[model samples]
Target chain A: MSFEKQKTDYMPVELVIGQHRGLLHYIIRPIVGDENLVDDCFSAVTEIIVKNYDKYDSSRGTLAAWLTKVARNGALSFVQNKKYAMTAGDRQDAARMEEVADRKTPEDHLIQKENLAELKEALKSLDKLEAEILLRKYYYMQETRQIGAELGLSERAVEGRLYRIKKKMMKKMGGAIHD
Target chain B: MTDFNEIKLEELLKETLPETSLAENLGVINPLGAAVNRVIAGMVMTTITLNFLGLNYILPTVGIMLIYLGMRTLRSGNLYFRLGWLTALGKLMLTTLNLVLQVTPYVSLMDGWGLWAGQAVHILFLLFLGLGIQKAGLDAGMTNPKMPTWPVILWQAVLIVLALTGINSWAVLIFMIWAWVRMVKHIYHCAADLKQAGYVVPVSTVWFSAKPLLLAYLAILLCVMTGASLLVHYTPLDAEKLVLAEAIGVKEETAEIRSELISKGFPESVLDRILDEDLADLGSVTDVDVLQSGDNTSNTERMEGYSVSVLTEDGRVKTFVWFEYVDGKHAGLVDSVKIQYDEDQVTTDIKGRLLYEKKGETWSADVKFEEKSRTYLWFGDITEDVWSISKYSFPFMADSPRGYFTWWTEEKDGSPAYWSFNNTVFNCLRTPLVLPYVELPENADRLILFGGFGSSWGQDKFQIYATAQFQ
Candidate 1:
């Protein structure tokens, strides 16, 4: 299609909703300890994106970078307002709850749903330990200590072994990863 | 074939944007741009005022005006506009004040009552502006309504009174004008917003163009030029005169010589020798020649000539002259030596190897002469002019009181007799006429005196009068 025709085509609303749904769990799951608050923040971000679509300038920066800035600002404002509203004792209780929630293991179900057949096949070729470490680190977002414990090694040892494995994997894959 | 995964990937990246935008869509007056305008206006006014009156006071007045305008704007409900105005005004005021004070006596005002009054007024104005703006902002946040006009009027009245009673009346007048500018900006922004919203808000006749700002900047340049011109014309003409007065305590010729010797960093003891004894005024002895035989040859040389001139203790004047040279030389042939003194030091232009030492009650000199071969030639003329010579015979106590007197007078053991003028008991220590006399304790080893006063103390003259004990 010509550039003019492409520009004229109306953006599908389902596409925006589908994108939000796909990334919603991953983005909020790490930050908001409370599941209910995570859902609310996710909804707010989606609503803001829809409303301010006309103001977005393609020339200034990438969509992802701009969205990230907005998200961070929103999260900071939410935290500030929350601190002002809570009493000293209530804040302490909230903080403790957040800490406990953060310590819970992140589910790796999203990785299985998102990766393509080719990417999955590449991941399968890695030795079980290397595969499991990479998956836990990137997909589940687990801390190195927890990952190391599950794999039966010290965190430092796990890091060193992971570094070597990544290097080898990158060479074998020949520029498969975008970053 | 349609790729389901490719479609899914594209769909995952799309998200709805926020309804609220960072950029304000409502029409508002650009406060920063308006402040830039005011600053330009101030600069122009300052330049014009300086050109007409040869004064630099307008710069600070302009600052006071800007603050007034900023406060006025802040009261009118737009915080950003006030900030912009304040920033511009503050920066310009500081810059112009610094420049003006650096080049003139205006900074001396800081030592007077005007300084305190000015500071108090400035502090009050700043406090008022800050409080007014913050209160208005908080009120707006709470009420979700525009600022009431009465509070602004009351605040303006208070600000005006503060300005009028403090430092100068001009400061208050300038501030009032500034407040007017703020009100204008607020109205302009409000009107602009209404117009944007399709309401027909009336436009003002006042035109805010970049031209006014440019002109104002030109005026500042003019003020700077005027100040520089005044500085050039009014500064002292003779740097030497100024320096001399600072170095030595003399007001005339001695100061000149002191200035010269100080610039050269000559020794203080040498200067003191020339000042204390009237050696500068001794009579000349004619045709004094010396002949020397070197390893290779023999040579004869006659004295060029030398004169002694009496000067003030501070070396300001050279009153009398004593000349000596070959018999055929004219009377005007000899130039009187210039004596320079500063604080505790003195100096003269007798430039050759002449050893001067104070022993017991007398000053002794050992002179070594050389011919002008730039090498060791033992042929030269040596002339010694003693202004005052004292001869004393101790045990018999023959004291010559006509010459310079040096004695340990305060001894509790009655009178001690002197031997001979050359004897250790009869040696007369030379003290410069310009130096102050100080008493020492019975067991004191030495006495030292620093004479010149103030910051430039020995820099303008020679510091040459310090005493040391000889065992």
Candidate 2:
């Protein structure tokens, strides 16, 4: 198809999110503390995809992966910026985050921030297959069986990928994450 | 109430992002862009390896291509800035040395040095690459360089272990491919960081264009190495000449040879008599036949067919010279000498006197008697009393055969000399050479000429005897 034709035929945010919601859930699940606010991240994730729809390029990655990344980035931005965040279990998570922050040196905190930025850069360096797999596993939060179906792999293969992404995360953390 | 609220919120996102056919309209991520660069890197590295074996002819050409590749790698941030240049330089140095060794007459020496330098440069390339990687990390805004520590150290260790244990080249190739992949991964990250920092990177494309040039360079290198080896196959003898000269304890030049001989326990008058003879003429030898057998196996090996003999006037110093070859090329001369001193007894005894000495006064006879002496010695009645083999076999076996003899004597330490041939207790007498430095007994009454004479292929032995009468 022509470039213009492809660009005009953009996939809507809802359908992309519908397919990859499970992936997005799992990526934010570790930091997500609120029962009521779990789905709140989804709205922000969807709105970010819709707002940045023109920037989404298929030559870079798949629609599902792009949506998942947008979702992941938006939710992370919310967690960091504390925007639209209300008290379901958000207060308890904030308390936990603060408690953890108090133990680490400010220098370590800065290092972590720097590492987080590099991790985003490392994401671009990943091969399309690895990037896609990471997106489906951590961002979409799908079960191994469902991700296996989407990627045309066995459940065990998808499980193996879960371990690999964990390693990738650790690498992005510059070996700071022990477990 | 929170769970009910979350369910309500989930209903909203699902309604918003429902599955649509628009997913099919999106452009696909092309794997080949990154893949093309990988192919170029692999081809360039293989080219580097082939040329690094010292193929000098096409090395500069390949080096240029590698520099281009290196520059591209640098532009893409796939290579650390300075290391790309160093790798190219190291490879060129190794390849040039390999080529020089092939064409030069100094093959043995250069080859030894090249081996050491090749391995040393290879390790240095790795070091440079590591430093380059560190630089790339610093540029990428890393607080501390997260150079994939385990992979780099562990993989190089694996390569070393494989090399030390004599692993096959295939295992090395496999490891290289793995290393290349991992290296590309690291470079991709660096490149990505650079791209984000507003750099316009040039990556390798046009894959098929480079394949033939690299392959052609390899083919040319192979042909040159083969041709050069054949052209210089005999060059190793240059080194071997020094070895031969050292063993013989003499210089190869005629004047130096004479001096070295006289200096090293040899009498000057003996050398004077033989130095002007045809025996001193030098000839390049292609083969050797061990005409006489003795305990000098090592000396026999160095015998390159050119043979010389000298006898001292006192019938004591005997020297034989032979030529030697190294790496199928003509080398130098080696000398073997036998010296006898008069005592109560010599090395061999016969009947009741020393085996080969004039017992009293000399019995004079015309020398150079090649015809009658040979006729009577082999076929005529001279063997009537001596043990003679019944000649009934081949024509060449028993016939009018010829041999020569010489006898020289002085008052034990005379200057002038003659040549004769005499084996030890083993019945030599094969090639006639002078036995030098013999002192006659005070009451000696007889003479024995060439005591070690025996018929070839038969045990028929004879010794021409002359009575030496002292008034």
Candidate 3:
């Protein structure tokens, strides 16, 4: 109860967290795949940042800018940890499985897969969040706050995630089959 | 930026991450007590250290308050975050041990392995603690952005060890102040963190101004240390003469010297005989006096002769003084004593800040001797055209170089004895000439001069301020 410097309206971190919820979702969703996995990544990131909140130095960058870096790195660390967890033998098997799945594609499925892969690669050319939002809103259907919660996201995060999906989908629509 | 947008976490990692089921945001909870914990814990540690070994200071109320605070923090889940509290506890424990050992007889730093072990542990504790703190946040200098790497911890530990040795007390103080400042920054940020998490936290009384307050404490400590150095560094002192004068007391000034000289097997009533015999050129005077400092007769009956003084680097001075048996005066041990005088004050520049010791500030030395006793004295108490009584650290009564039964008082076991040479204690290396106490004389020039040939394990060299002119 004795920690305040002064009283203010609204939870302070929520203001910042609210502003960047979309970006955070964009960074996290793909890496984690499932909603529960997304929550795990999000929780660890927010905890690391919040616990070390006092260490934020504005000289390095603005708070908004710093948060972006932290979110990116936190997700990276989570994914990297998972990546390194598997033994070399397990990783080879996994890679082999992916190759086998690629070879088993239907003749028409191959064309479609190539089309989607090209689209995905083209989407990477633009800002990722806007692209992901574009793709999800147009293609994935209504992404309600309930879905946001299920993905361990604020309502704002779901909106941003859709924006990135759409933005990336647009790049694919334009490039179509540039490769 | 060029990475595929569709690339998923599952695809990148060959294995699935061990996921946590935690959904609630525990980080948002208000850290109301951490602010309180820092303030109260700091106050407790400061009070205990300043009060010294006096049992009265460790009031039951304070102890109870600390325990209560610890419990409160532990309950609130901040005990892990606030490990700094442990460091204060360590200082408290070590200081208490020093007090206890002082009262116990036959227990010394050399003999007390338990105490030495404790001191070692405290040093290690502080080192590891600093490393931990570094990990939890950014350094004050802003050079570090995250937790301390292993190399960072190693270097921090090394610096602390040097600081404990008195080789870097000032350096330690500087770094510590910087750390406190940085920690204060972290505290304020943490408060905002809680607020951001939707918690209404109250204003902290001490945490807001903790940085400036820490700096202020350091400033006051520096002021006290500076005053002490000026007293010892400015004056030109003859260590040999000062040691002899202090060892013998103002007996030579009064009729006490005559009585003491006769009682200890000196030439027949020199005080009366010298008055009637001396004209000039008093050469190589020698006498053996019954040492009062010794606990036993074997230690009591000791003899002494001339001692010499030499100027060391800067304005510092040292003495080569020794003591022998009253019967076997030649076979006695040599005591290496060092000193300072007020006649040679020098302005010191600390961290680019111009500082000067005042004139007429008496220079004194306080060698934290062994646990049993300590030898200390101030020079330059000129009275009635002659020097009055000056306390000499050489506890032996002008008898042996290896002083008989001198008071040996040590704060930490296995700590070096250089700081307590004559009357002053240097806070750091670079031969601090900080402050306080008078200077003792060397040779017959009626001058108090201090000059030395660095410390050595060589045979004890002795110096005399002036010949014993019993007038």
Off by over 4 Å in 2: A1-179, B1-72, B75-79, B99-113, B131-145, B149-209, B233-471
Off by over 4 Å in 1: A1-179, B1-107, B110-112, B143-471
Candidate lDDT scores, in order, read 0.34, 0.38, 0.35
iRMSD, per candidate, in listed order: 24.8, 19.2, 18.1
Candidates sorted on lDDT, descending:
2, 3, 1
Best-fitting candidate, scored by lDDT: 2
Per-residue lDDT for B231-317 in model 2, tens only?
332111111111212323243455554664555433453344332222233222211112222223222221222122333323332
- Evaluate model 2: give its lDDT: 0.38
- TM-score, model 2, chain B versus true chain B: 0.30
Candidate 3 C-alpha lDDT tens digits along B1-471? 134533432121111111110101112112233443443353334323333233233442244234223322322222333344454455445544443333222225434565455455444443443343343222111224233223323444555566567675687678766765554455444333322321121121221123343445446544544444433333222232222233322333435434544553553422232321111112222333221213221111223432222122222222222233234212111122322222222211100000111232212222222211223444855322211112222221223222211212122343322222222111111123211122222211111112122122211223323211111
Instruction: Tell the DockQ for candidate 2.
Output: 0.02
If both were scored by TM-score, which would come out higher, candidate 2 or candidate 3? 2
* lDDT winner, 1 or 3: 3
Ordering by DockQ: 3, 2, 1
